[model samples]
Target: MNLTLKIWRQKGPQDKGKMVEYKVTDISEHMSFLEMMDVLNEQLTNKGGEPVAFDHDCREGICGMCSMYINGEAHGPDRGVTTCQLHMRMFKDGDTITIEPFRAKAFPVIKDLVVDRSSFDRIQQAGGFISVNTSGNTQDANAIPIDKHAADEAMDAATCIGCGACVASCKNSSAMLFVGAKVSQYALLPQGQIEATDRVKNMVAQMDLEGFGNCTNTGACEVECPKGISLENIARMNREFFSASIKG
Candidate 1:
């Protein structure tokens, strides 16, 4: 298949960026989006031109490193999949796919299709760690059996890979979905109860400090999240936050 790609080109964070166009031919429908990108890069290299720069670690979608805004949608036109998991068949021949990095004040572009996502790291770091009873008097981990439903939900929440799709998809650039998933993963389980109050407070504080916008209940984050992280997690996080606020 032949396609035209209008990709953002930026030399550095401080450099002015613009959309640059190119053409690719004979792309297989089975090729994962990243593979198609590799083909584009190869073509550029063969012509002595700088190739597009995008992030991808573990193309299997486990890492969530392949962040791209394709044709105005986070992770392209697919549902419940990361950019690396997107396939060429999602589009057709003679298609013009516009690709850019995830855009948010918190996610500034570092270069072409690569953004500074260390902000997410800082938000996560602000959550700190869960308290564990490692003392000699510790009970067996399996002794305090968690409810099956809560445990399952907690595990689901833990599936979040820290991808910024929530932020990118939000009109307000809110990260509530991501933060909600992080908080809920622990909030649902007994092991996470000890630091629940501080966990929610500190993480929310850090989220605000990072310049991420507030959630307006638009539900765009859940719609774009590759992991299918639910909006219910956001509601649970709000409850956790309010409860923490009340206690203090």
Candidate 2:
């Protein structure tokens, strides 16, 4: 297959950026999106032109580092799939593909298609963890009898890989889905309830300070999420936050 790629290029956050076009020919449909980009970059490098810069690790879709906006979609036209897992077969021959970095105020561009996502780490640091003593083996695996339903829900919430697709897909650039997933992961676990009140308060406060928008129930985030994390998590988070606010 052949493709025309219109990709965003920028030297840095302060630098002016624009969409630059390039043609890629003879691309295999079996190749992953990142692999297709690799072919394009190889051709550009051979021509003495600077190659496009994008992030990718563990291309099997586990790492959540392959971030890109393709053809105006967060991770291309596919649902519940990340860029790294996106196959070239999804596009037809002679297709014009537009690729851009994840856009958000909190995720400023570093260069080309790469954006800094440390804001997510900062949010996690805010209160995404439990303060358990690591001094010794204190509890057995079954010490806390977690309900099967809660355990399953917690595991589903924990599947979030922090890819930032939620923010990119949201018109408001809200991180509510990401934050909600974190909140739900802990809210359902017995070990996490110890500091649930403070956890919700601190994390939500930090999310606000990071300039992320409020959830507007547009459901774009849920649709674009590679993990299919539901808006129900956001609902759960709202409840947790309200309860935390009242208790505190």
Q: Which candidate achieves the best TM-score against the true structure? A: 2
On a 0 to 1 TM-score scale, where does candidate 1 land against the true structure?
0.97
lDDT of each: 0.94, 0.94
Tens digits of lDDT, candidate 1, 1-248: 99999999999999999999999999999999999999999999999999899999999989989899999999999999999999999999999999989999999999999999898898888884686667888878789989999999998999999889999999999989999999999999988998999999999999999999989999998988999999999999999999999999
The candidate 1 region of ten consecutive residues with least summed lDDT is 127-136
Question: After aligning candidate 2 to the native by TM-score, how far in Å is the CA of 96 from where it should be?
Answer: 0.2
Q: How many residue pairs clash in each candidate?
A: 0, 0
Where does candidate 2 stray beyond 4 Å? none
Residue pairs whose backbone atoms clash in candidate 1: none
